[model samples]
Target chain A: MTKPRQWIERTIEVGLFLSALLSVLVTLGIVGVLLFETVGFFKTVPLLDFLTDTEWTPLFSEKHYGILPLFSGTFLTTSIAMAVALPVGLISAIYLSEYASRRVRTILKPILEILAAIPTVVYGYFALIFVTPLLQKVIPGLSGFNALSPGIVMGIMIVPIVSSLSEDAMHAVPAGLKEGGYALGSTRLQVATQVVLPAAFSGVVSSFILGISRAVGETMIVAIAAGLQPRLTLNPLVPIETVTAYIVQVSMGDTPTGTIEYQTIFAAGMSLFLLTFVLNIVSYLLRKRFREVYD
Target chain B: MTPDKTKALSADPTHAMEKDIAFKVEDLNVYYGEKQALKKIKVDIPTHSVTAIIGPSGCGKSTFLRCLNRMNELLPNFRIEGEIIFDGQNIYDKNVDVIDVRQRIGMVFQKPNPFPKSIYENVAYGLRIQGIKKRDLLDNIVEMSLKKAAIWDEVKDRLAHPALALSGGQQQRLCIARALAVEPEVLLLDEPTSAIDPIATGRIEELLRELVKSYTIVMVTHNMQQAARVSGSTAYFLLGELIEFDETSKIFTNPGDRRTEDYITGRFG
Candidate 1:
């Protein structure tokens, strides 16, 4: 009986360990595949031109494989999304966590989460049909398939993500800190902004990075609302294609499997992964660099 | 409860005041939801004097100390009954804002909570909250308060550094300086030196002794010797009741209540 029990324990332990190792193996496999294909893309299109060229018309007769267009697309959408999400999400989070009565918070939190749970495809249509019309009233010459619509909808999608993460962060701030704030005769807003907000800065930054990363990787909404024109421009009112949207466009079309066009998707994905990875590292390091240690 | 009685409770304008006291309490009781933490605690905290509340763990001395500044009321289910009269006004009156009460009466915790900010910012925080933004004004108060807390010389050069980098004693003194910067009428310290070393504790006690000349001090201490040394008046508490309150010498030398005597002599907690 003792022998069987010990053998069983060892078997279970090994199984758990191997299960944990599978994630690492899968990640490495993905990196390997991406590097193999990105090398293929760089062979046909020079690495410097791919990065620096003004145009990104890969499918057109006058071909230019500039990666800048996709990067800027990702940059604009992520910026607009963050501009929408960060303040709205953070303020709502502060209100929910700090000031809202228990009944109101209970009612509001689930409603915010449900907004997040709505399918991204539905949000795509909402952007094109509902949001673009609203924006067109204010700014003329706004394209029907523009970056602004998808960016705004994507921001709405990430709102719950930002608010919930930020709420959790603000909630984790020790009650002692807020009590100390009150002890100094600070008003509720002062305590929330001056003390609690600073205390939860790292968590709040982590939330923003997570929200922006989500916006970068978002596919369906951008593919539907933001047109397939991968033009390198900063004007949000113009139709533009993000790297993820471009990959979606090509994948849905008849691009031969073994061609350079096929490998370009992998190259795009590799850059996307690197973009998000760099964002997480940079924000976390920046937060830690200037933060005050409470514990 | 009526208007005329309320005026009389605050003391009539024609009446000549005798002892300068910080707080006058009546039938003060505090409860955490269902369970009572303090029962009928009635005491006078004299103005410009150090009053030490000495008790064992869970004896409600800390709870009583928190009641003065309405700090205990911050807990979700905390409920208070009766009145705490301060500056001839009931601090718990319906019209009285808890923020205003806390501003005039400040508190320091058992552990040094220095906001993880710069030494300069820690002292400036209270004044900043009051909306005085002139940098020179903040600088002067920060210097004066830090000097008053007796940690100015050690921290003057490192004012911009993170407050947590300071030693435990220095951090506690910094907290004191932060409290002092607000110019509170009364300062409540909840075991301010419990976590520090003997030398640091001595430094803090010395600072408190000097501080009582201007601000009234109410300190909760686990150490009976500390209570005997620092406080002008001492209140002995046991099981959520005020067992005795008198001059520090009387409580330590010849306490009136048996429970107070037993606690002082270390017969039982």
Candidate 2:
């Protein structure tokens, strides 16, 4: 009974709603699949055993299923990556926002962005070939496939994310606040560090959280460079396997569908998802706090 | 159309000036690229008194205030000619450190722009940057500055609270306290009370009157009444030129320039 124009508008409205719902549906589907397979994984391996077991050698003749090794590996690499990225990215953002001229910023910003555009696979190979060999010369005991090289490479890869986002946050701070600082006779460095950085604290913290989440979920870089040995050790000189690397290794191999070993990837994925979800929540809370202060 | 005050000010730049001059601006010309913002400005600001610069928007009043602290140099393509003599040295001299100039001539803006920090930290920031790490000294200075700014009683209990939590007027007072913490010789205010409500504006005017007892104050304000109420002397500017400079009472009652009189009487901005 509707007119043609009214019908067309209704159709478009439905289509837009469907488009919005599609992403949410896909996310729910992913969570359902991960939960289903993780449940299947727990049927064979007890929860306590999965949590407490130190060795993660499910593929070997003697099987073990502790999540600790993967957790430790992921933790170690992410820590190293953060340690490298935090200072470097923050400093670059300060230079870009506070010190660099408009022309210099225009030139330098795209160069930093290009670092993000570089393929992770390329970075993986770079970690294995160039960085590892160089580190081997400097630190004699470093293995060919250790956590250090891949960690550093991953840090280099995520620098753009931290810098670009943090810079946006710093840029968002009111110019009036900075003017107030300069009026108080603060030098350029003091204005940047004391006023701008603190004012943009929530945004900067959000960047750090995002960078850590990206490092945790990173696959190819650690898979190719960091060896597939899931050992519960913090030593960067030794080979260690991250949760993502193990998932990648399992997904690539000839393990049959729904097998306990294959289902292990889903359980590992769930843990990764949960960790990133927690990080995102923390970032959201911090950003909310910032909004409350300013608004 | 008698231009008595204008002729006197233009003929002798230091006419009716106090012996203790805080600043001597001589042949000052400011340009932002091709456009001139301030044209051939010459005036002497006396110490320990409020000197209000009154003009319509874009008349270079704010530009003139910023020049005293060398804040104009921070902008792109901003150039200034002539001398701004402060502390017996030309602040525009190549060898004179800008940091030192700013330290001596602190400024406040139209809107209260407090840092997103604790009330205590906001006041203590100036000394902290100067590397004064002593806890007792910082505590003493923060208390003294807050008291001087007339916000100590309101904010004393909430020193740890965020500065942004305060009302707009309180925040302005906090900013004033922050500026006072550094103990600058001159405090430049660029329409500081324009953003606040009348009650807040009255509080600030009264505070300024109290402050002029010790520190030199140069403020740019659009409000003629505020200039009359708070300032000792008033400089009337029109189209980037100083039209008249005289006592606040004389300038209000009988302006020297026709432009100054017309603008003051609300005939035209």
- Highest TM-score among the candidates is held by which one? 2
Over 4 Å off, model 2 = A292-295, B1-18
Tens-digit lDDT track of model 1 for B154-224 = 99999999888999999989988998899898999999999999999999999998998889999999998
Model 2 chain A: lowest-lDDT 10 consecutive positions: A286-295
Stretches off by above 4 angstroms in model 1 are A101-107, A138-140, A287-295, B1-18
Candidate topping DockQ? 2
- Candidate that scores best on lDDT: 2
Q: Is the docking of candidate 2 incorrect, acceptable, medium or high quality?
A: medium
- Per-residue alpha-carbon lDDT of model 1 for A26-140, expressed as tens digits? 9999999999999988889888998899788877778888889998888888889888999999999899888987789899999999988899999999998999999999989
What is the per-residue lDDT of model 2 for residues A1-295, given as tens digits with 9 covering 90 to 100?
Answer: 6699899999999999999999999999999999999999999999999889998989988999999999999999999999889999999999999999999999999999999999999999999999999999999999999999999999999899999999999998998999999988899999999999999888899999999999999999999999999999999999999999999999899999988889989989999999999999988998887752554
lDDT (tens digit, per residue) of candidate 2 on B1-269: 25965765576546555347899999999999999999999999989999999988889999999999998888999999999999789999989988888888989999899999999999999899999999999999999999999999998999999998899999999999999999999999999999889999999999999999989999999898999999999999888999999889999999888888899999987
Instruction: Report DockQ per prediction, comma-separated.
Output: 0.61, 0.70
Please estimate how well model 1 matches the true structure, expressed as its whole-model Cα lDDT. Answer: 0.89
Interface RMSD of every candidate?
1.4, 1.1
